[model samples]
Target: MQHYTVIKDHISSYPDPIILRKEQEVLYGKEDTQFPNWIFCTSMATQKEGWVPKQILTTPNKQGIAMATKDYSAHELTANQGDLLLGLEHLNDWTYCKTENDEYGWIPTFCLSASN
Candidate 1:
């Protein structure tokens, strides 16, 4: 199994969100017919110390990718360790975040470390 990481430290808001897509072809000879498998996601939520993660919207809406509704688009999704995050805006130290904004497209280079 492949290991993943959820950039929990970069979160900057609440109600995080993620999407999943099924694989059509087997990359390493793995046989599985699960449609809409796990892909990637983005949300916002302040951690224990006001750490917020940035929400990520898809670039071109991959296969089986479900788009969030306007009502629930602002909601934050839950993320745990090994969730696999790219990066967004900087908060301070050991923390960064991103989000799916109407104006700004996909920002995958924002990051903030934790303040020790």
Candidate 2:
């Protein structure tokens, strides 16, 4: 695990984030220009929407129907500035992290700084 300090406060945008199972279908939306490598997606079954890593999505056809390459959880962490966290996984400029309180979720990389 890697340590990080929250440089900027981040509030969870999605209280109920999207979840994708392997090979599950989704509707592809727009890509996030500010944060590259992430695209908006809505699960076909659950209809929950969130930003998912573009790499995890299969190429969409003309109808914007795509499949998930693997399981993905879009949960996000609500962290305050100066908080310490442990990042367990990193993908597409986001980090899967656990807060000091043991609450775990994803946080944007830009909000975190490497801790010594």
Candidate 3:
């Protein structure tokens, strides 16, 4: 899978839209995106999956970035500026990513800077 970095803060995991709909059909016999313009993706590190806005995901022009836009606390990590991250997938403005510490979560797209 491709890699990315955490650019924004307060990124969290929701249900994968595709899987959510599939589960909805299985559990309640229905399928839905839950919200308009939402999409789905799976995490790379912990394999956590979730749904996000369609506008969050974007095609990266470079490898990744080296800093985080805000302080993030997850997976036993406190991600601050200069933390290395790998982009696993994109969902709208959110990017499913894994940190150098192997922590996984979603981050905003604008916070990343493609590695040179």
Quote each prediction's TM-score.
Answer: 0.21, 0.91, 0.42
Write the number of the candidate with greater TM-score, choosing between 2 and 3. Answer: 2
Candidate 1 root-mean-square deviation in Å: 16.0
Q: How would you encode candidate 3's per-residue C-alpha lDDT over 1-108 as one tens digit per residue?
A: 555443444433433322222112111111124444543344333344444333333422244211212222222223555566777665555456778767676566
Q: What is the lDDT of candidate 3?
A: 0.42
Best candidate, TM-score:
2
Residue-by-residue lDDT tens digits, candidate 2, 69-115: 99989999999999999999998889999888888899999999999
Candidates' C-alpha lDDT? 0.26, 0.94, 0.42
**What value does the lDDT take at residue 97 in candidate 1?**
31
Model 1 local distance difference test score: 0.26
